[model samples]
Target: MTLTKPQDLSTEAIATLIGKNARVYTTGDMLTQDFVPNRVNIELSDTREIVRVWLG
Candidate 1:
């Protein structure tokens, strides 16, 4: 996925795109512990827009 900063991709779209490259994908609030080690964790804004992407 050739993602650029501030891209207007939705959380679901980000998940699908990352899922294609990663073995697993997860989405949740920043305060939550919904993360899998060695997996991709996607953080989205309140409007469901991609805010951050990282490996847990």
Candidate 2:
């Protein structure tokens, strides 16, 4: 799925746009610094709201 404004979408909505191998996380969570070129990173707010979307 494609979004005109991904950061404005909900976590569940964005999750559906990604493949099964995507990475989903929220603020304050500890994550590895390693970068995987094909990985899709979805960052959510503390209240489980979608905040940002990007690829590695």
Candidate 3:
């Protein structure tokens, strides 16, 4: 799915847009030890704003 640039989307919006099971990473949060490298990393800003969307 293609996301619009500079859109102020919330985590929920991003989750819904991508998928409920998609991996979400907020700023300062530690990466999961068992995290698998794939298309499921969604980075969010400090205010819970979507900053980046990952796809594999």
Each model's lDDT? 0.53, 0.71, 0.67
Q: Ranking under TM-score, best-scoring first?
A: 2, 3, 1
- In model 3, the Cα lDDT at residue 14 comes to 57
- lDDT per residue for candidate 3 within 20-43, as digits (tens), equals 546677777887666455546788
Q: Candidate 3 regions off by >4 Å? A: 1-20, 33-38
Q: What is the lDDT of candidate 1?
A: 0.53
lDDT per residue (tens digit) for residues 1-56 in model 2: 66554355444655577644477888888989998887778788866566787787
lDDT (10s digit) by residue, model 1, range 1-56: 76455456544665677663332222553354655575665566655455666776
Better of 1 and 3 by lDDT: 3
Clashing residue pairs in candidate 3 (N, C-alpha, C atoms within 3 angstroms) = none
Among these predicted structures, which one has the highest lDDT? Answer: 2
Clashes of each: 1, 0, 0
Can you tell me which runs of candidate 1 are displaced by over 4 Å?
Answer: 1-35
Q: Rank the candidates by lDDT, best first.
A: 2, 3, 1
- Decoy 3 TM-score against native: 0.47
